[model samples]
Target: MALQIFNVLGREKQLFQPIEPGFVRMYVCGLTVYDYAHIGHAKNYIAFDVVVKYLRHSGYNVLYVQNITDVGHLRDDGTDPIIKKALRAQSAPMQIVEMYARSFFEDMDALGVIRPDISPRASAHIPEQIKMIQTLIRKGHAYEVNGSVYFDVTTDPDYGKLSNRRIDAQQAGSREEIRGEKRNPEDFALWKNAEPEHILRWDSPWGEGFPGWHIECSAMAKKYLGDTFDIHGGGIDNMFPHNESEIAQSECANDADYARFWMHVGSLTVDGMKMGKSLGNFVTIKDALKRYRPEVIRMFVQSAHYSSPIDYSDDAVQGVARGHERMMNAVRLTRRALATAPQTDDGNAILAAVEKARADFTAAMDDDFNTPLATAALQELTREVNALLNSGTTVGASVLKAIAETYDQLGGAVLGIIPATDDSAAGNASREAGLIELLIKLRSEARAAKNWKESDRLRDELAALGVILEDRADGTVWKVN
Candidate 1:
């Protein structure tokens, strides 16, 4: 089956035909690097990582580019006082860019996300951004106000096409207050006039200032992937002003569509509330990694479809941990079964099951990269593999190899949840034992105080951490896996 993905533009799944046959060029908008990444950031990046992985596995040469936004993102809330804190902290703009850029890579690496082929920073492509802005000005799509350049929303008839918003229909002056020079409230900045205190300023034809957030993406994406690319991806939150403005600026300047497919992943929520720094309910990826294995975190993000909101909670993560372990157990059993199963030529049933699972998985993924369905298909295969083990069936060497290969291709190469066999398993066992003992002591005190939520939370967290606490009629006993 040909691979298909839901084009957000058309709001339906379409067969994926790359601009260049047999090759795919993809871009994902990356972090702004003002702070440590949260789980929401993880969901966006990991979802796209799986897409890139599956595309490559399906025999497409993929050139993936994810940008590092080390500059130009402003403090949306007016009260923060210090705008562009990241740029001002370092001795030079490049220092700030490299510092946060490296940290972003480190966090992504810990989450098992494969690094992109090219990670261009906004600061490095100033020339390209300036050139694009100049083109927009020459094309009469933009105008200069003092040192700042603003994209005239009135100039482009298709200004809000990406977000499906009409410029005239929008609430006037609802967003950031328009400067006196702006022609309309909907017009967005292409270049900002840096204040004397602005530390990240650059000398340009528009005078000393930095590129706007949307302009950086248009400039860098076109610089690397040309005027049009196969796929452009980001969080759904970017759909309105950020992505919509990108389409307007790029299309107005280049006289062509900006991208073929616009993919937007949904946000990650905490207890049904959106997770953001301003909300003060956000958990950093580093804090999450300290508790759960990186593979477990990746599985948690992939459990839901990319286009659907994923509610994050202790219970939700624990459920994912259980599911991930079940998958790993199947992998281990398959490996052991392969090692000892008798070699024969008559194991075609198992071979057929494996092939069927692969075909089903590919088909589900072809339908708009339905990861949730693809994940269910993997679970079904795991059940079948376990059932074959329990049935005491004799398997041929070729069939065993095929099963192992399929598991590795889907679980390891694409979904990226392969279990690691290492000395850390022993360490995990010791840690669980220690944690269980500590929790039991705490539970005793909680029970005496009638703190039900505390006791239950402690018990649930321990169980989710892979420590099973069995409460018998007589008493509670714990076991560490």
Candidate 2:
């Protein structure tokens, strides 16, 4: 099947034909960096990360750009997020931004999320933003009011086309109660005048102020990816006002389509409740990595399609942990058998089935990046390899190599849900290794002395620490669970 994406602009699935052959230019909205990145942030960013990974796997030279909003992200109550955070922490706005931005990258790195090719900070791109706002004003799509500039939505006939909001069909706002500077309530701020106490300000032609939250992405994306890119992605919540405004201002300023395809990931819920700071139910990536491994978290996120909402819980993550462990164990088993397999052909029929899973994986991912189905295909490969390995059948050398490649390429490279075979986690266990070795010695002594209770307790304690001990034919060998 041809690749298809559910573009929010069209509100239906459309073939994702690239603007240029064998190349994809993609942009995703990133964090405001006012607070710690939470599960909701993980949901959006991880989805986009998988998209970029799959595109590269499919032979697309993808240029991915994600913006960092260090300023001008106002809350629903018209309060600056960074300023409010600074007040609470007794720090400056830029200080808060720098602190959280570093922590955010650290968290993402722990989760194996690929860093974007270019991560432009809004505060650093004041000139580009001013140029875009100036272009809007010169084209009559925006007007300066006092010391601020607002997009003239009525000037663009297709203002709400992205969000499917018909301008004439909607009731007009009460113009009498003009609280803000905009002539129309639908007209959003392109650049707002910085208040006297505003910590972040830039000298724009309109006034000394920062870029709006929506304009930051447009400015940075255009600077890196050009006027019209292949895909623009973010959370579904962004489709209404934020993305809609992006479309309006960008198309008007550039006099071209903003993004060819709009892909929005679904929300993340915590135990059936929507994740929010006010609700106190959100899980941060820092907290998540402290318990579960990164691959397990990836498996948890990819269990469902990108468009589906996932609920987070300890039980759910534990189930994912078990599933990820099973896949890894199968890889380990197949590799061990391959090490000693004969060079001559054994004509094992299971190898053929395992190889076909490679095609299945490609097909699943090509169909709009159906990662859950792709993961299922990877599991099928694991199962076939394990079946042959466990059946005491030595597969041919070439077939063994094929199985290993499928596991590495599709499972490791494309899905990124499989940790590397030489991952440093094993090396990092030196201290634990010494502790585990001592315990193993004690357990051996207990078994030798016929202390059954003590031996069982030692084994049980190790198991609790995610170290499983198996009594082999010669002795016990421990592997991380």
Candidate 3:
């Protein structure tokens, strides 16, 4: 089946056809770089990362671009979080941006998200933004007043095409602080007049000012990916004013479509509300990592559809971690079996199961990147593979290799829930697995000798270290807790 994407622009699922044959140009709005990336950020970025991975895995040469906003992410009252963070840290605004930007990438890397091909910073592309704003002004789509520029929403009849908002219905000049200067309440800023004390000031056509939060994405995306790209993505919360305004200004200035498909990830919530720093209910990615493995977090994100909200809690992530341990156990055991399996072609059933699993996984992913279904296919295959391995069947090395390759491709490469190595905290290394097996054997001997004290001591020690041993009638099997 061909890939279908839920494009927010048209409000329907459409077949994904890149502009250029066998190539895709995609852009996603990036972080503002004032604070640590939170689980919400992880959900959004990981969703897009999966999309990019699947595109490349499908043989498309993808040019992915995500921007960094160092300046012009303004609050309702004209305050920049970057500047506020700078003041609190006793540093420059750029210093705050640099620090948090690197931290964001660090968290993403730990989660195994592939980095974009181009990471254009907003501050570095002032010329491009200024030029885009100049074009808007020249085309009468925007106007400059009192050393500030605002996109004239009244001029674009299709202003609310993305957000489905009507200009007359919106409370014009709702923000009294900038209402007096803006022609309409729905009008949004392309450039803001920087204050004398503002540290992140730049010289623009409007005056000494900074680019507005919305303009940076439009300018940067166009500069890197052109006016109309294959896909544009961001959080759903930004759909209304931020994304809506981008369409108005870009289409008006460039005389073309902004992006072909719009994909927005749903919010990551806590206690039925959005997880945000302002809400004080957010968990930073670093803090979450300290509590759970990165793959565990990624699995939790994949448990829900990208457009469906997933709640965060300690209990939720713990459940995901347990399930991840079970999945990795199947993978680890298969690799171990490969070393000892017979050479005879007597495992055609397992090979057929692997083929069926591959087909099911691809179909699920092709259906709007439905990760939960795709992952379910893998989990089902794991169950079948486990039963065969534990049933004392004469499985061949070729069958084990095929099973391992399916997990490595669909789970490791596509979903990214499976790591390339078992050396991660989430999975026991081969050496560690061997040592645990040896200890299990010793504990068995102790039990056989009726030395309950030594047997219990070994069991308790392993449990303390999160190695859970299940004693079956045949023998004992262990899994990472």
Provide the overall lDDT of each model, using Cα atoms, as 2-decimal numbers. Answer: 0.81, 0.83, 0.88
Q: Give lDDT tens digits, candidate 2, residues 1-481.
A: 6678888788888988899999999999989898899877886888898899888987889999998899888998878989998999999898999999999999888888999998889989989989999999999999888888888788988888887886652434546465366767787888998888887888978768777888888899899999999999998888888998998889999989999999989888999999777898878988888888888888888888988888998899899788787788777655655666789667467667876787788788877788889898888877776667666555787777777777888888877787666321233346767788789999999999999999999999989987888774445656685
Give per-residue CA lDDT, model 3, range 91-126, as digits (tens).
989889999999999999999999999999999999
Q: Distance from true position, residue 415, model 1, in Å?
A: 1.0
Better of 2 and 3 by lDDT: 3
For model 1, residues 1-481, the per-residue Cα lDDT tens digits are 7877888887877888999999999999988866678889999999999999989988999999999887787766521112455445735556555666677789899988999999988889999999999999999999999999999888888877778888764555455545456878888889998888776778999799988899999999998898999999999999989999999999999998889998999999998898767888888888889988888898888888899989989899999899877777667656655666667744668777787789888888887778778878888888887777556567666677787788788878898887444222223356645666678889868867999888788889877986665553334545445
> Candidate 3: deviation at residue 32, Å?
1.0
Clashing pairs in 3: 172-185, 173-185
Which ranking of candidates, highest lDDT first? Answer: 3, 2, 1
- What shift in Å separates residue 323 of candidate 3 from its native position after superposition? 2.6
For candidate 1, give the lDDT: 0.81
Candidate 2 deviates by what RMSD? 3.0
Compared with the true structure, the alpha-carbon lDDT of candidate 3 equals 0.88
**Residue 461 of model 1, lDDT score:** 89
Say which candidate scores most in TM-score. 3
Off by over 4 Å in 3: 169-178, 277-279, 424-452, 467-481
